[model samples]
Target: MGAVATPLLAEERVVTLNRIVAVVNDQVLTQNELKNELFAVRQQLRQQGIRPPSEEVLRKQVLERLITTQIQLQQAALLGIVVDEETLNNTIKNIAAQNNLTLAEFRDVLQRDGFKFPLFREDIRKEIIIRRLRQRQVESRISVTAQEIDDFIATQKAQGNINSDYHLGHILVSLPDEATPAQIKAAKNRALAILQELKSGADFKQTAIARSDGRQALQGGDLGWRKSGELPTLFADVVMNMKVGDVSEPIRSASGFHIVTLFDFRDSERHIIRQVQARHILIKEEADDEVKPEAQLKEIRDHLLSGGDFATLAKRFSDDIGSAQNGGDLGWVSHGVMVKPFEEVIFNLRDGEISAPFETQFGWHIAQVLAHRDFDNTEEHNNTRARDLIFQRKSEEEYLSWLRKIRDEAYVEYRLDD
Candidate 1:
């Protein structure tokens, strides 16, 4: 009887440590998980120089985010979406490279910053899974037609704010799908109240942290810089007339009522592409050859520098048959037209200045810059930009709608206080 009582006591301790915070469908979120997420969020807020809200307010916000994220994860599992181990490792390596660290060094840095390396890796995996899920579910469904692109471009031109960019702060008082008139009025009234607070000099970020339902609520509702064409049609209409520092009235949309503050605005300068007229002679690497490609190209470059005819030498020995016949003339090349290694070598060369032998994926090359120009590509740029912006605007709208629909359908039961 005493041994049985001892086992019961141990089981009670385990239950106490792994107390349930929330239940979503078939899974439960534990208290420890919530605590860890809360700690991470506080650290992030501090790093961003934003004061963390009161614990009570933040806990609710974090819990809601956790629930939504859990729902997305469940859906991802159901749809057979996963991040392979190799892909996850490669992503971590890329992140480390971006920060100028090796994988081991990155792990050390995480440890030094008080983050468990295993936890960080899992977090990255989850982020990748969620991103892929969004791509598969929301982004794949959106489309922008040619007529829409044409209309978008024309509208931007007529508005005279085609080149304008806006940095906005947003808050959404959300409502359920097919909400009743009473719910609509309630949400509108709530949005209006929040707007009045902003107008009366309340801190927009703090207010958003406390009340907003937008995806970026935890980030203080800040919707970083966006071109005019990238804004939702509803937001574009209201924002075009807004002055910097002005808070907008609640704008209605399918998701909910929104309030936005124009934090900053700027005009993009005219589109001018830097074009480099360059040419190169390539010597494709051959495993059977005793001479290495780079060494061979170096000898050729020395000959050209020693008063040899470039066109004659290129036509005689260059491996690129297409350009070799044309005296190795590549014509005018823009920034993104060539591979990175090739562009780096050619773009940095002065007119008539030849590069030493360098290796790209196509083997080895020696390049010469003929001339440079700043070409006005405004019309072409605008057309491409318009198409992209229309796609972005549509994607944002659809993603928000999709998110709301999923949240509405998910069965979430909170046991935070219990």
Candidate 2:
């Protein structure tokens, strides 16, 4: 028998131990890397209560997303770009403050979300790097002339138009993502049930507290007056036509079922701010990790309750920079001017009455409404409007330009056909 010649060609692809996940230049993406990012992604989605694909599917998606993101970031780094730690920390602090958590509490939240601190820090780092790269590389190149801003404003005003805004409140009931089809149906049914109850003389607030899964549940599902367009299309549609004290039927959304109540409909209400010449002392709620701000707020609350000068105390103790500078004066603010909770209280207050200390996205505030006024357009107002228009136009141009450059320069490939 003749000796058989050996075939050098392998019939199949062999996986290499050296290939952890996939390497882009020197950056090696590992399973652990994908896991960390995916953990963060799932945490964010979970907070929104959004339903996504299975963990396996999400892992694949996160891996792809990170890889694409890394490409953009790498290109940015090549331009000798970076973000300052102070700015990044402040950004995180602002986000935490929006959720009413102090820095420590916010850290706890990220920890509980199954993310390592380094993972979160790196997430922020990359975001800042991309942002700085975009600003330095792209945004700095884009500009809108002052004349353009003026022209846009004039054109808008020539339409005899005030920017359209709606003042309405809502009651929302959300369902978990892991919910079954029956559960979704049940959620909708419960929303309908709430509507029926409201129509049958049940208190809207009471129903909301008992049934809503959203954060609005705490305030009885009172969304407390947002612009008409700010709401989801479905919710916005029903509320726009309805008069005050109206209740909506079950409104379906990806987040689950929603029901809205229109407490008041004020068009151009935002432009004509109902100003309350009020002073306030704040009392931040005391959590163990956040006692100082809280204790300070409580002391202020006690003093106000005991008859200290609201304005005087506010100037000294209130942390509201704009208002504190003016003796805790929030100059005439439109419907959406203040945070939702504070706005509700301000609008509800009759002039000269002090409110009970109320907590908002900010630390707690105890506001006093000295007076209320309708809006007037003065030269100052027009100038202020013009400046705002300029900022908005410039910011948008910069933001869009930044996004386009990153997205266009990104090199992405999909291994899975889907």
Candidate 3:
């Protein structure tokens, strides 16, 4: 009430209108970032011909996705996860090549499309870092046992699902964010009802158009020809069990309930490779020796062909200590196990015939094929395929669960309402 001078600070302060939409740990997501992401999302949806949910739904979904990305980036930074300049540049260049544009043209195109070049680089760098993080933290934890591989191979062979491709149809009954148990139950019931309709001779495509909440719903839910490791783990085992035109039971996921149909199937044949059993005498070059490695190997080959015992020469002169003691026996060499130069020469050799000395990175070698066979590697082939499939399936499952665990543990705050 004293008419003294009023505080002068109020007149000098300027307020900024830029809003923070979300808080991810110590990082704040501003309105500009949210708008940019929403714009990108809308463009993507339009390109995909997807009928996205309401604007509010789209905004919430996009915001949540951004939050997850932000949290991951923050975690990556804490762990010192980084993508080197060379790798990032190469990755970008490869992407440009894939899009049929040179790197300079790609930069121009991105700018023309309203994306800043620096921002795009950062996005790609983040992606590579996240992939590396997943490989280190998630994939490394997964293990495939010898017995597991054998069993998996046996099962796949029995089911004839190995080396098969599937054309699939999908239907999703999506639940709301933070869906309550009651809502989940309702979603499941809806999924079951749709499944029943599908089984009762309702046209699957027509039903999908009318009912599915999937992004591909308008396209009759058709997921065209996918091979092993190309599909999400949710569909791997289920699809294998399904006959063409058969619909699956509802499968639960973070988003919703999914129902899949096997629209078509086909078998892809495996390849057979020839193998050789061979022996070699390798002589490494000595810098101080008057005789060169090549000349030494040639002399050894001459002695062998002139009736010197192969085993005695190998033991006396061969540098391959492990095989030298065993008379230079390489056991059985497969198509790809040995170096190309060595393999090419050895593979062409007639049984019990010595070859002229040849050079490989490992030094000089003279070889003889003791035996060769037109081996049927179908079982081994299937086992390799099965091992990969099982590892991929298990790793994908573990990756998702690990991602969810990390996401849940992070501290997030919403400021959008304010």
Measured by lDDT, the strongest candidate is 1
- Candidate 3 residues lying further than 4 Å off, grouped into runs, are 1-22, 29-64, 89-120, 167-179, 189-237, 241-249, 253-256, 301-315, 339-361, 366-374, 411-418
Provide TM-scores for the models.
Answer: 0.89, 0.43, 0.68
Per-model CA lDDT versus the true structure:
0.89, 0.65, 0.81
lDDT of 2 by residue, 1-418 (tens): 2564334322221222223565655666765676566666666656645454555555555665677567768888798777778987898889899999998998898788666777688788898887777667666766656686567557546643335444555666665545689989888887888788889998766565455555444344556545432455456557666777877777886567777777766545333435666566654444564456655666776777788777788888777777786778776656756678888898888887777667787787878888888765444455566555555445544554444445445544443323
lDDT of 1: 0.89
Candidate 1 — which residues are off by over 4 angstroms? 1-10, 100-105, 286-303, 306-308, 312-317, 376-379
Model 3 earns a TM-score of 0.68
Best first by TM-score, ranked:
1, 3, 2
Model 3, 52-90: lDDT tens digits are 556666677667768877877887888899989999999
Q: Best to worst by lDDT, what's the order?
A: 1, 3, 2
Comparing 1 with 3 on TM-score, the higher-scoring candidate is: 1
Candidate 3 lowest-lDDT run of ten: 9-18
Q: Top TM-score: which candidate number? A: 1
Tell me the lDDT of candidate 3. Answer: 0.81
Give the better candidate number (1 or 3) by lDDT.
1
